[model samples]
Target chain A: MRTELTERFGIDYPIFGFTPSQEVAAAISRAGGMGVLGCVRFNEASELDEVLEWMHENTDGKPFGVDVVMPAKIPTEGSKVDLESMIPPEHRAFVERTLDDLGVPPLPDGNRVDAGVLGWLHSVARSHVDVAMAHARKYGQIKLIANALGSPPPDVIGVAHDNGVQVAALAGAKDHALHHVEARVDIVIAQGYEGGGHTGEVTSMVLWPELVDAVGDRAPVLAAGGVGSGRQMAAAIALGAQGVWMGTYWLTAAEYRLGATGDGPSTVQKALLAASSRDTVRRRIYSGKPARLLKTKWTDAWDAPGAPEPLPMPLQNLLVGEAHARISQADDAGVVAMPAGQIVGRLNSITPVAELIADLVSEYQESAARLGKTLD
Target chain B: MRTELTERFGIDYPIFGFTPSQEVAAAISRAGGMGVLGCVRFNEASELDEVLEWMHENTDGKPFGVDVVMPAKIPTEGSKVDLESMIPPEHRAFVERTLDDLGVPPLPDGNRVDAGVLGWLHSVARSHVDVAMAHARKYGQIKLIANALGSPPPDVIGVAHDNGVQVAALAGAKDHALHHVEARVDIVIAQGYEGGGHTGEVTSMVLWPELVDAVGDRAPVLAAGGVGSGRQMAAAIALGAQGVWMGTYWLTAAEYRLGATGDGPSTVQKALLAASSRDTVRRRIYSGKPARLLKTKWTDAWDAPGAPEPLPMPLQNLLVGEAHARISQADDAGVVAMPAGQIVGRLNSITPVAELIADLVSEYQESAARLGKTLD
Candidate 1:
């Protein structure tokens, strides 16, 4: 009856959902759980503000959270990330040709706005976080601040705690999980290999217990990666996890803003199968940051024998951003891949957000019942 | 460049392995491949001889095989199978008394074998195949036959193949791999799901492409489920396979066999950290048949409420023969519940057989290069 995270997150069930849409997030929270909005995709500042304002008017004051990226590596250090000039011309040419072949529109040749992953670094991520905070204050119910990439920098951590908002970060390994603990972070989310964005070798079943052991009594471990069903949620809890952090599951939720077509993660199972671990070819093709995704012709071209390699953070971000925007909206998906975790095999059908949450709880109850009898 | 098996089996490689040891028929004709033994902890006379002696002696003088079940799968086949009699009321009563108190066993008890599986279909597995065909006639060569339970069946498949004798087999999913296509049966084996005895399931990364997919392609596939070593091998190749089978990958190699101490699997990093997917669980009590192994005690009482009941065939075997053997051995393992498929974890160290075979072609090339590259 008394697990640390159950009370901390204020939920009857310790299931946390992450999504790129606000409606899905709010619904998960309103269903007696927590939902965090993924905040890195908005290309403009006003867009971020607009979404947050909408979230404020809609949530009816339920608890919610925001997520951003702060990877361990970056291209530059300064108040602003000037992404336009950092990428090489050859890379840009290749992307331009790919877009042309894809029949997607190119930006007008004129006054350049900051262009790639470098175009969306701490400056961009923080801008969205600022939007999250202003709106959280307006609504007075946002309960947490989470870093989707690496550790939350000291300043971000300090600010969130000051605002009575719990700060959380993602970790791919046991060592990284410890980094979260030593930093006094409220949660050290130990992710397994089957998660959506970035992940590591161990599976959720194997990693959950390891994290519980490593973080002993220090931080409540929020298990992330490879979770898409109620049985899985129950299994995680049976293995000692205090809560479950989920993202990929929400991609198919009805209220999410993503289009029904060409969302690589949506039709994932139909295309790929049988990789030892995953088609996790790390490329700075999106956000100019080295991210894992299903393999595609776009990645193969960069990895081809003679292609110019990817640049670091912001520069790669600058180089790939527009291309990301274009391809995501195009039909040549085989030529361009998208971010995904290995759990895609199980991401088969679509269901409503509230139904998904309710099913998970019911399944969790069933699994617990199964496990309890075995122990008894 | 030459090893005993290479010359004997007349193939480029001599690493023979498979799940069901009696698959001596299909394994032998798996051209240029070897079929070891396993899965016959509960074998019969006719079943073993037909496939081993009858089939092996007739297959274009090609090598054939047999294997045995050692550790892994707690609940072997039970009355669910067509046994002459169900595990006596006394046996069931004894099983109940043993499980009064215990949590997670010494393990998570990956997978368990039940006695109800074979359900008293008392037939000599390839073990009898190994035994009944003593001196059938000479053949191209019997690469090898191995076993997970006791030593060389009644007559190791090699003896029947004559002077150019060779044999091998491992446990775990070995049951699924034991069928001969066409060839003189030479080997019978058993490779545990765990790294020792019979095993399965836990170590997903270990590879034994030889057994899992050899049928119809010349020889038959050879697998010992919990094989451990390379990360990429986990991407097993059943590419052009008739069937894919496995067992845990741990054993009594020339240097590691026991010296009357009733040896258990090694605990080195290669074994311990291998992976549970290649491990096993204590299933049946052992002598009565369910495999005796190291694992969680969960499998011992699978009939608990709401637990999906296991079926027959191999299920009852877990609780019969092997369970009895463990109790007689008075090994504390009796309570640990023997079935094991997670043996791959103990497969940390490599022995001469498989390593030598995989390396043979490379070594042959190395030798050829020393002599110059154009021999072909």
Candidate 2:
């Protein structure tokens, strides 16, 4: 059956869908492949339990996975405090002044943004990973665990593998892949510069092959940078890859739990282009570490020239997370930006996961069929 | 102070460098630049005199150009014609006979390869451009030219342009102010993914602002491809551009004198990678398409299931094009490739001049750049 991977993962197809929404995870699993939930969104313990229970009831024992944010670098105690504490009052003053000059008027409607929004960005991130692990232990659908940023911590790895679950991590550079190997990650996702969110500066054509060369055939190599279509998936395999790991593709799926803010369609093109890597400021703005986000007014104000850099790890994310929440609820397009990949270029339209998967298989079949002629 | 290009082409920057010795034609004159001779080892034409002398003395005192073959694209074309081809027509016959036994070698190279040395690859390439143009007119340094392929087209552009000449062409990707552009081409260049001939498909990153952008109020933009580099160069100038236009970079450079001998470094890489799109291959093949190369016997053989792709452009280069003179002179690693665009990664590197220049800047820089970082 040329089923090496299917035999290993126990999925009908070798495809693996990655999404930030837990609901999307269940949907993909129900469709026959693997679906991984981005557990990073759930900030509290009880909230995670309820979500896991819901997934179990909905998916009816289908296999799925979870995603968490674990940055490569953790901030030191002195610098990892609340934004007001880590950043000098002078730095904070600069941000306010820049916004004032930009003519950013005070929020109308008695509150332009929730005052508590920017406070929980970090603790929630760390807790999300912990919570995912706990949920995996309680649920049968969780077969894998992934760290969104770098390699999962040894403890996280222990919990995953101890329970017979595979571990995967996202990486941009050759150096990062090396770290994952050291951490013994079961899969090394060599994402290219075309990938989204705080990506490394190397394009996939160059980076994927380089990683394959560097890693050899130790663990399966999943190409995950600019993949949005099946033809692209075929090209990745032709270049020597085990399978394709897709994330953004799932964002546009009908089952995606992305409740719209009423700005436009739930499509990447409409929402992503308006975003700048700056908008998705890579400050330790959210779950700590540098994360690319939509360049929101808050990110802009915080990132003005000569402004204090955001704090790191759990602390920095903790300080400003409340801001993320309130902004999402505020319906202000300027404050809410999707943490998407450069592959957003391919997210031209939205379709169901079933349709997308069928397209992948069909496109892949067509690519092979065309190449078959060259062989003849 | 000569300001090199100013004294030569009456413009700015000296970033001319490339394959196709004849590319100097429009490449030099249009930018108020110079051209050089790309004389290969076999360019023993004494008739070469009339060409250089005429150009030295004719052509509206405009800059001229020239170039030479730079080797690249390892495992070049000689393989099929080598002892491998010598495997006894009987062995080849037997292999052909047994094709039904194998499940189609799995890749293009396993299918079939064109045989024969790419006749008169470089010498004829360098000979005709500056030689023919110079022979046709007495343009002098104003008739400056470049050896689009190898080492300064044997000092012709410099010897004459020195007497008030201009020599210029295209560079691979990276740019240092005084390097080639700094050497003295009245204009500077910025080629991106949309360009042709031995390109790296880097988009405008290393192509535009890096070159056109790096100069800031300095130099002009001869943006090439998807360009013409123009929309982008126009955008580049928005980022900043001055003057812009580029042939298929190679085809446009040589001015149709290249006739179809397989040795023009301009399209070597295309002959290496077999896929017919920009994505199939991304590496430095012939003459350093560090941008992109055509798929061919040279590239395919190396990327084989168990084979190693060539080294960097410089290293792999030793095998393609002009090396065919030594096809029988040596082995399989020395011939069979050309330089073109990453688009050659899409198809052949050869193209028409109008189409080539059309993609570069054509009064489009201001709006394009404005769009890139537009405040609106």
Candidate 3:
């Protein structure tokens, strides 16, 4: 558990839990791993600041982090209304027809669906960084800032460094890992194709070793994707990764709630729990960039013949944002737009965050011993 | 290195080396690993019988195996001429145009192009099994018979068992593994998407554990795909596989000669040696089934717009078999139709087969020890 990642981050294990739920994030930090609260769901700065303050109060002084979706190439800087206006009419019509076909009704009265992915815009992401930096400066609880899209802008990295918070970025390929290192990012989360969210084509078994060889000397590499058990964690370490950065495995954690609406174990979680490793598909429908999502009726509809190609980032998210909102509210497992990994097959139960971490450690130890026995 | 596989097969290690070259297969057996010779390239029974005889003589009584491309369902049974006549004119024109664009010359005037994939037919694969069974009865060197496509027809499995040889089938999904076990295959090779030749969508990291949970009690699971080092092998064992089955890592072995014509270090080998993990594409261009290949000009041509959709199974193989022959003979690295895995990135050297096996063992031990230290 005490790799360079743990020592550098001052955490008990090299495990980094990614969740949008402050409850789960706080629970993970309390259980001795770094809890990274995803900030892309927060469009307003004050909403994120309140969550950070709540995280500060609930995490019992344990270290936590914030993840922002700052695309390396800033896309269309505009207000939410302007961005909504930019979405094509045909794309909106397609979404409406697909939602109608799926029978996912509109949100109930007074439930306003804002434009999707407001945080993906550069302006909103900047506000996210400002809020995270302010939290780091105020409570000293925020220890890291992770850029989900790519390497953060230089000014953002500088602000994070000035606040004494490490900056980390996720890379799916060797070239991207090298680029992150060249940009002086602190740590590289080498995510493979089986990972949840945006990923590259290489599977973790190959990509981890390739990336470790590419940037292990410069920055510690954490294996992401295809990780659901301690044996998998052992595999990551065996492949030369310093630790594991897991997101999907935390979805069914007992402490996890829907980040946007704070609902516990909704139909999305049910669908994810019932999935197999083969139940996920990689598509651009989730975020415009190809991300792994549960292969439900919603994804299948988008992939059907004659379906329009997904739009570019932010635009695509904007088009589907309201559809996603309606689906979430509908609680229909068949059409949920949930981001998950191939590891969804292994999430068969709900356990406390503390117990899950303990099990991971114990399983990791047993796996190491089993491997030793093989060599002997 | 002793696992259920090593114990059952009486091999020194749990490693199974797959290669199409008899020389390389013999070297793997001689080096204390079970070498599985690919039999799909042998179009004639006499050719396979002669190779099995040579394997018996060259293996020094070490355990070896034979792999045949016997799809679970039977395809058309016809003469090579009939199969050739079935390929459409448009497909032929496409191949010609693509090869011409790549600057690959036609074969010499006397050299004959094949109808392609004769061995994929049920008759050819049955002959391969018969030749292998004869070898098992005579010299006892053929310890196993593996079906590359799926669970071999029940009769093939029964015949192998009658000859006192074990049968192994490859599966990529939980349902496929369950079907194989239900059909009473002796061993299951859980191949992931990162594997060479034919593969499934699930990755080794996730597929291994899923297959193990599905059929480990009835059959031993051998992890295949994305394995280039002993560390990857250790990862497989830790994921509950009894051993590792690897093929791509052997492509550049000094002893590997092109099985078709016994050529050494051809342009195909050169291209594979130069590839990165990212330099592969999973396309139906190789065999009608989706297989990973070096992302060369040939594969790219097939993927280009206006290219005809690849034909199904033996027909597709038939359509492109002559093109493959010409490409192999022409020695054009840029357009070679080579079936490789994502692990091609690691095949940078042409070490002898014996040295490669040794490196794997030593690396496995080192990786196991490293995991042990992490746990400590």
Candidate 4:
């Protein structure tokens, strides 16, 4: 499982895990794979700085990374208040009607919901990158910074390179990857349509090689999407990827099971474990983008005929934030929205991060050995 | 490139090419890869028998296969006339209006178009299968019989087995693959969303592994969809596919370029070469079912508002047969409907079948070697 990615990132394996939890990220780093904390959930620079500080303190000086959502085109380009005004009234009404129809109860008394759309807009995400870079400079432990939506801006790429951190961007198509390379990013994560979050129509088998043939020599291409096992990792490498960038597989890890409060699997984690690959649907019901998520009454309601089309980015996120908060507090499995990938079919159990990494390494070795025998 | 697929089929390579032209099919077999002749175009059993006889005489004792479209559920189980009667007048008017709007000229004088919808119905397809079985029984060189839409009927599978011919079926999902295995299919071609003709939403990366995990031990799985390069073949093999079943790549082969009468590439081929991967769309314009096809005026017209939706199976195919004849005769690239996968981006040039096979072999070896180095 050791490739140029392993040596470059100073990890035992080339598998990179993306998670929002600091504990899971630290566990992944400790297990010899790079754990990248998703910074999109953090609304303030102070919160992000705190998480980075926590990660640095807990991982025993192991290297990890941070991911921020920085789409090239933001729906609105001002303060969160201005972005909220851009959301259409009909879109907001539709979201409310859907939750009302689904019988998703509101948050418990006195639990106020935040109405502001925080992470998806350009200003917020740019601030996120700035804060992450500042924390990386102070801590010297963050080795990678990944832009989730599009190519990282030139200045951000420059700052990351100047700070000795590799910059990576997720591309669902070859053209996106070529643009990323042109932007001087050090790594390209070619995420396929089967991937959990934002994706293009191209699948991993086609997207990996197309990106590899287009820009593999220029940058280390990491295959993302439907990679839940060691054999899948071997396949990604064989398809010309230097490593694998996985997120959904780590959701059910033991570290994630023990949440911020040291409790067992979250409601979302339980939903993910019970899901089959076919259970997920790519719909714009949550984030205004076609993100793959668990098929719940929330998603189904939006898909029904006469439902208003979802607003773009910041607006859509704004419209759904309160509804999402309400559903989460209610904790009803039927209406809870859980973002996942087609790889969920293989995620039928929970294990420790170290054991998951070991299983991937062993499966990869066995697959390689089998192919070698055939070659012989 | 040798695997159990090669040994079982007695071919030098495990790659199987599916094409409607006998010339391309024979050329593929002559070049060491199995070529399965697509039999949907042949309306008459006599025409199919003649082509099979031609393939037998041209392949020089090499093995080949046959492909028949036998969808598990027929839209209409009655005769061609009864099915044609089911097509509404509005559907016929819409087809006429579309051809008129596209400026597709009528066929030349003395060239009468066949009005019968032949390939999609159960009776017609079953008769085609019976003729193929008879030919296979008569000629021992045909080693495989593939069902394009679904699992071959149990009796057909039994007959093929009795005649020492293997049965293959195309599956777009894991459940479909399991059904094929349950039906005792010797080979399951797990095609992804990127595949041509009919396909499910599951992409090759997800579909290949899911199908492999479900039925790899029960039956040999052939990875299909978006497989246009040797690196892709290596990826499929690593993902647990025994071999690859390819179609769109052969459409631009030199053999296809040199048509049955030694002419140039067909209008569809020219259109295919000029198009990008994004140019193809999965629509139910030509066939009643969703199939990936070139985005042309033919498909676009049907998608326009106020246009009548296409009728089911034989009815839709029947309604459009004459319109297709007019477009092909007119040689209008903009109106020509060509079934292709997202891999159209890589088919930039035409090459002979032998060179294509050699390139694939060399590329596979190179990719395997690179992975071997990483493993060390």
Q: What is the alpha-carbon lDDT for the whole of candidate 1?
A: 0.51
lDDT of 4 by residue, A1-376 (tens): 5788999978888989998888889999998899999987777778888888899888888889999888787653577677778878888778777777888776678465663347666777788888888877888889999998888878889999998899999998778989999999999999988899777777787788888888958998999988999888888888889999999999888878422233666777778888777788888867877888887778888889999888877678878888877877666667777778888878878788999999999888877766665577
Candidate 4 falls in which docking quality class? medium
Off by over 4 Å in 1: A43-45, A75-83, A100-119, A260-284, A287-290, A300-308, A332-336, B1-376
Off by over 4 Å in 2: A1-4, A75-84, A94-130, A259-269, A273-323, A330-335, B1-376
TM-score of each: 0.54, 0.51, 0.97, 0.96
Write down the C-alpha DockQ for each prediction: 0.02, 0.02, 0.79, 0.63
Query: Regarding lDDT, does 2 or 3 come out ahead?
Result: 3
lDDT of 1 by residue, A1-376 (tens): 2356767766666778887788888878877778887777776779767877776677766788888776656643564434455566788888787667556665555334443243257767777667666766666677788886778777777777767788888876677888888887888787765566666545454456567767899988887875766655644554456778988677666666464464443333233332222344545565444456667767776776766767766566666666765655454446545666544444445567788888876655544443322212
Candidate 4 RMSD computed on C-alpha atoms after optimal superposition onto the true structure = 2.2
Determine which window of 10 residues in candidate 2 chain A has minimal summed lDDT: A113-122
Question: What is the descending lDDT order?
Answer: 3, 4, 1, 2
Tens-digit lDDT track of model 3 for B41-145: 888999999988888899888999999888866454778787778888999999989888898888888566553478778788888888899889998778888
Q: What is the lDDT of residue A204 in candidate 1?
A: 53
In order, what lDDT does every prediction score?
0.51, 0.50, 0.87, 0.82
Model 2, span A184-285: residue lDDT tens: 998888775545455664445445555665678667777776566655555455444566778866766766747564445543334654442212334445
Q: Mind giving the per-residue lDDT tens digits that candidate 2 earns over B9-82?
A: 46432223233334345444444433444444324445456445544554355554544443322333343234
Local accuracy of candidate 3 as per-residue lDDT tens digits, A1-376: 6788888878998889999889999999999999999998888899999999999999999999999998876454577787778888988998989999999998887465763468778888889999999989998989999987888888888889999999999999888999988888999999999989898899999999899889868999989998888889989998888999999989998877773345567687889888888899999988889999999999999899989999888788888888888888887888889899999999998788999899988889888888877656
> Which fraction of the native contacts appears in each prediction?
0.00, 0.00, 0.77, 0.59
